[model samples]
Target chain A: MQNTSLSQANPTSEDTSKPRKARGPKWWIDFLVDLAGIYLFVVRFFKDLFRPPYEFKEVLNQCYIIGYKTLPLIAFTAYIGGIVFTRQSRPSLESFGAVSWLPSLVGVGIIRSLGPLIAGLIGAGKIASNIGAELGSMKVTEQIDAMEVSGTNPFTFLVITRVLACSLMLPILVIFTDILALLGGFTNVYFGEGVSFSLYFSQAFSTIEMEDIFASTLKSVLFGFSIGIIGCYKGFTSKKGTVGVGKAANSSVVMSMFMVFVIDLFTLQIMTFIRNILYS
Target chain B: MADTKSNFIKPLFDYEGRSRVVEIEGLNKSFGDNHVLKNISMELYEGENLVVLGRSGTGKSVLIKCIVGLLTPDSGKLEVFGQQIPGMKSYQMDAIRKKIGFSFQLSALYDSMTVRQNIEFPLKRNVHGLTQAEINQRVEEALDNVGLLYAIDLMPVELSGGMKKRVGIARTLILNPEIMLYDEPTSGLDPITAGEINELILQVQEQYHTSAIIITHDITCARMTGNRINFMYEGEFVLKGTFEELSHIDDYRIKPFFEYNEF
Candidate 1:
């Protein structure tokens, strides 16, 4: 009877009925969890970016996709935006006898804020959306997993190359947007206010500083990186199904544009503080 | 052939006698209280075409995932090429994965890349010191083997379903892997195309003589490609045998599956 009871107790002792405890929290728990996922993804991307058998071909492909392919849209919209923005601001300035200040006013506005912001917004629509949708579709179709199975790091191949391309390319695109906006501002001054080309040219540079142009251009780089990385991240980690792809693309542009403004506001504040200490 | 216990028992324990390449013992995986794989065990030898036949949700893909270290089993021991791999680092797994190839069901060809670029991707990813000429040669050879040499410059979108599958196979072949894992190589294709894919699989099997594990539901595909079949049902293998042995088995679920002639 004792032997039988012991045998029954041994089998029962090995029972799988005890509820599995939840994974507990610990020191560096959140850090470790977040590390291997998105944070590790970002680190791996940078590491692979500098490493060789560098996908120069894929980089060129991305340049075409993110920069060259979207040029027409960026150019056309920037031109129109410049024309409209100058014309719209003319009425408001004219009400206060600030009409003679048109060129400097427009120049300051373009270099300081409008130039980077508009280009980033348009890029948010064009580049970010494209990155998200493309990667989202890849994720949904198992193409990303296939890359892993084939011994190719998908993040290195797909995301890093794209992020690098956007980082390198968008600043150049912003430069183009600035040039077109200048042309458009000149055109608006000529057509809307009958100002001479020479007068508009001289007035535009009268008050503009090297710092203003430099700061805005630098900000666009951050804007571009944010857009590129965020877009790629959302798409790369997308779940669910076909609808998930669409959501990723949509969310990428929205979230990136939001972050761009947030960064811009903080940058402006920091720059103001630095300038106050240095020049004032 | 007689319905003997020895044939069934022989292959299950053949790991000791034969040169085993992949040995998975006592695999148990669960996703938040829902058990996906329960005590799954199998051994694959060199140059053997092993097919895992199962219903849709029997963790067939999960099993292959464990082999490749894509999904960690909750409890198990999996050895690949004599390296114990349960909680191995990704870099270590990457070293091991260099000798493995996986062809997905959707083909998973990078749509952003052209056919030539897709095939060249693996060579570019794996080999660093090779010259442009050597890379080009390998890419051409792989594309030629898959019969897609002409479509090199065309985008993945331009290719047909069969052509995409061939490109996918070409990409896998670029790595010259020692083991190949095929996930439903032929599911949605028309019969003729499916047969062509099977022929391609057979051609690869003959030429490379690498160990292959095919996870599929189609009996016709299994019979055409697999040298040995393992019937996976309810998180475990219900029966495992050659096509002839499984056909002769006197069981309910196993009977119609093996004997039914869809071909």
Candidate 2:
């Protein structure tokens, strides 16, 4: 009796995303449910990961989109990061009359942390939000259900492919960021101190080892995975209507960025643990 | 009130002889504390368009979604082809889903793909063992059936609202589903466009011999497409009969629905 018009094709019959006023006892329940939901989502991802007539074409397409389409931004940001870091550090090094150490310092910084973090943060914002919004739109429009009814396992085709693309492409993007950043550092140092390109690179790389590169690559892969999974989860579970799509996109960006930093902290500890065992 | 409750609507035509392809008894669904569906029971007879008419928020869409296993019911005896749908795993449901074609209200076409790609989707995934040429031929035929063969190359965004619905039908028909679930087929459409869609629904029921459960509030569509009608309110059927039987009901619950179509 409240209204007479139809719901205009919204799934779930009613708008389930409408806020409930009282949350006194519901807070803990909500938190636990969300956590459990994420856990099951991850489980589904892994379960579908191994058993599949793999969506190779979609995976490749996602790689090209995630990697190739994102190259310009990654490259530009890393180059700027290298320039700014070098510009700021030059004066400090010069005051101590130890400017000779600048190249080595720049190399370590870029390879060990800066490149991976930049790639992850940018991927979280760009890639994860896109995944969230795209899938969220699909969810609201019932494209995911359509896929299911059409006999395509949506988790396998959509979720697995995007996540795999992210993992595969992140390492590659991190490498590009690392190389661009160094080239940017070289440009700055070469102009400021008149250092030759070859000599600058040689000094820069002198202090870096295989461990630094391996750690950075690991972080990149983990960042990619986190970005993909969080985005997919938000999108796949989005309810209500177009409003839910917007929320999904916004939360995906925030959560994936948070996850990127979390992975960074853990990876740093992991790297230290390995170093102690290896170097000892 | 007691007299009216005792006089609940019944079928004027004998559909008991028809085999029920979809059967529901005391079906219930809830989202948190909001119980959307409550003790609902219905049956979709083979090759008949069973329209469940209800205003927004009456759990009409939820019912169809439950039928197709897209949404699980909280408690119910919901079945398609007499197989219980609620507890069936997704893969197991896929076998059943191949026989059900669900044409979404918004068409739900893959926007990134062309119309031809959308039509080919169910065929490429569900109806395996077909060659590329066979797929192409079938896609063309499906499009031809919907009178949109020229739009095969166009993206979903480029097509008009009616065209999108037609393409959606083409896609589902490519699978030749035994049961078609049309969720608000004419909800957001103009009367003329809605009439075309209603005609298409009837044509599908005739040509493909599909048993359809059309969830709509459009009385015109309900009249045109439905073999029998059930008017739902607050998660339960308030009235149900053939259009002939329902149009004459003087009850307040049923008056507004048939009032518009009255001569």
Candidate 3:
């Protein structure tokens, strides 16, 4: 007989459950359970984020896929949206005799609200569904299980990299969206009012505050986190078979879009409260 | 660079001159109200192919999943190499997992990666200080073992079912796993392909001298590859013995299995 040897592995994925109580209605019970699962999943992401054997290579790859690949879609939509919104808003501003205020108005609107919302919605749609379907397919087909058996943590390799990529890439995408949308506004302003390039940009930057950019970036980051987490949670826990994968993909898009608006509402309230307390 | 770090898992030898690598006692698993595994007890000795024969939904997959730390058994003792592994986290099982290779029912090769990348994955992630050439050599060796070196660069979608299974085996084999857990290795294949897979399982055993737990309902696969057999039905073992001993048994639940698959 020959002597057998052993190799090393470090998967670092998640926990399992034993017999537990189920209270309340089935849907309510499932809701609480899912809530708890998402909480743990997010907590584990932070824990695994700092753990050793960091997968920077995979993170970079995900950034390229999530950020670079989605650029074209964001640019086109943001530009078109800028033109349409600016054209509509100009009539109201002109009626109020604020035609000269168009550049500053568009700048504040896009930076403080429009740019982030567009980027958030677009990111949620593209990145969330893709992650959801990809991870869901892996779950059902047992590729994730295969990774666990191989000593590589699928969560770190799959979830953390994706979530981090979304978080890091969204703000950059927003910056691009902000620029392109402002340019779209510029096209409309130049055609409609014959405004010069330098004068229009000067008016745009005059009302822009650093705090506004910071607030928008913060919102973008949160939106990115929601996009990553919801998609991952759905995909990671997806069940049944191909149907489950499809459901995961579909729900990721819907949930992510809803989350972006919900987050927007809450953040709007909090920022308002802070501003009132500071100024009043 | 060379790896100086080593991990050793010494198997426990019983008085009968056989070592039990995996020892399960009173194992039970359930989902919601459905009791999938109930009061199951079994043993797998060193270098032996132990087949857990069963029909669909007999909790065979859950049983092996528990052993591999994919699913936590609701209750019971599951020991691998004398270490208890019930409800343990993934990191806790990593050392033990390196020695256990599980082949899924549907060959779960990483869909995005090529066959070469798939085989190279484990080594690249876990094993340290190996040059690219060394990794490539091990990958080629593993694929060659499964007779799939020709399809190394191809993606999984391009391969046939049997070829995918072969690649999955090659991926696991590349890890140098001491204990192999095959989840219906011959399922979803034609008779000829299934026969080839069974032959491959035997060849892996003969070459690697690895202990394996083959979960299958196919009696021919059991007869061909299992050193001992345990029949699973309704979440419990109904019958167990060597192929010759099980073939002679006169039980109703066991009769149809052999008559249906073996005849």
Candidate 4:
């Protein structure tokens, strides 16, 4: 390792710039490559999913790690977010003489959109970055290659478990988030809006039909799955070096954030369409 | 002496030369303008320890990766267990991969997993339809073999460098792979620890009777564990011989490597 540094008397300016900027191609080409990589990952994952010695135990272990372990962080974030959002939104609503509608409005809005969206973003920060770094380090150490030589499918074992865990557990987390956010709104009504606890819940729940809750919950599930899958994918496919690992971790967060936005827009559109068809 | 008798008495090295575990012929790989492996051809027989010695960037690790189907060569005929590798389907490569084990130089135990969990990972995931008890037994046996039975529950971070390498060995052995590939097993270890690791490699090689191809520039380690050592330079296998024979070679290109103790 020391010899590697001795041979290069000095790094040229171009060498430093290469890491920060992707030269030799237009920006559009780089974007297309990134898009293509995402597409290929999705296609390959589905392709290799069912064929072979199944890694059920690994998937279960991942669920325990990714899903079960992340519970406290998700719950704490959601609880605080709910309380703070409601508390902050209360004065504005009161000035408009809309204090009575606090529970229904905050409850529906938080559960339907903000709760899952913010939760997914937090998951990106917490779970996605972790997955990237962990798998990135594994790549750098050649553990993934070791797995391959040992006649084990590194992808099937490592990638599948993590992706599946995130896909399955993220929905459960979002459900918890939804409940916590509503409780926070309920608390705000009791303390700030001068409404009784039972009255706030009953009124809040009355306005929120099953469709509203379900639509938002569904989006969160997809959001969670996307975050987990993209994070693990980037990390697992990282190049075999220290720099590669850092790049993988950085890309995982960037791609996950982009996916969250894209998925949110599409989900919102579908939700609105459903509402229009049902009510109209 | 009893030492000679004990060494001779150990029938672990005996192999009838039944099958080839790894075969590389006319292999060629290049990274951009720099060629890494050129016309490389070698065969790894069952129960043989083949050590590859090379300087940095000599395609040693790349050669191992190609055998495992991790990286595809530019042009090559590579075969493992009678299956052609260059054109084999991904699923096919996966099937062949199940019969191999790898111990990385960096002791690539998953940081998030406990030592036991790391060892159990390959078996728990790859070997289908095994009962939970069976998996546990395998994990225990693997850890015991590497003398890491006590540290099973500890995370990778808590273990020393030596302990981490042992856990990596146990993980590789969980599947009882027929072939094991080691990449610079002693590169980053202290002399004493490195010796211990070499002993562990010998033990695993003996007990499992698995064919091993180790990539390292450490001459001491190669001498201790290698039955046949191949000297690689500039993407070529410049010399191949038993360690005893290679150490005595008078060739100008190879003699300096030994004379300077540069491996």
Each candidate: what lDDT?
Answer: 0.80, 0.87, 0.86, 0.77
Highest DockQ scorer: 2
The DockQ scores of all candidates, in the order shown, are 0.25, 0.36, 0.25, 0.20
Q: Candidate 1, residues B1-263: lDDT per residue as tens digits?
A: 11234444233313334577899887888877667776667778877788998778878988988898878889988999999878788788888998898888888998877888888877877878899999999999988998889999999889888888888888888989889898888878887988888888888988977789999888878888887787777666667777666766676666676556544
lDDT of 2 by residue, B1-263 (tens): 00133334455434656788999988989888777887787778888898998888889999999989888999979989989998998778989999999999888999989999898877887776999999999999999988899999999999999999999988889989999999999988888989999999999999999999999989899888987887787787766666766777766666887776668
**Residue pairs that clash (backbone atoms under 3 angstroms), model 2:** none
- Regions of candidate 3 where Cα sits further than 4 Å from its true position: A1-31, A274-280, B1-16, B87-89, B261-263
- Candidate 3 lDDT, B1-263, residue by residue in tens: 11112422232222256688999998989888778887778888888898998888879999999998888998889999999998666677998999988899898999989999999989898889999999999999999999988999999999999999999998898878899999999998998999999999999988998899999988888889887777777787766666776676667667887787643
lDDT of 2: 0.87
List the candidates ranked by TM-score, beginning with the highest. 2, 3, 1, 4
lDDT of 2 at B177: 95
The runs of at least 3 residues in candidate 4 whose Cα sits more than 4 Å from the true structure, single-residue gaps closed, are A1-28, A51-57, A87-96, B1-20, B125-138
For each candidate, give its TM-score against the true structure: 0.88, 0.92, 0.90, 0.84
lDDT of 4 by residue, A1-280 (tens): 0000001011121111112343488878967887787678778778888977677877898888877788888778887888888888878888999877778777777767878877788777777888898888888876777666665677777777777788787778787877787777777667765788778778767777788777777777777778777787788778858888888888888888888889989988998898899889
Tens-place lDDT digits, model 1, residues A1-280: 0000000011112223235788778848844653356566677677777875477778888988888887788787778877888888889988998988888888888778887888888888889998998899999998988888767778777888888888878788888887788778989889877988888878887888877877887788878887888789878977788898998898888878987899789779877887889798
Candidate 1 Cα outliers beyond 4 Å, as residue runs: A1-53, B1-17, B259-263
Tens digits of per-residue lDDT for model 2 on A118-187? 8999899999999999999999998999998877899988999999999999999999999999988999
Give lDDT: candidate 3, residue A193. 93
What is the DockQ of the complex in model 4?
0.20
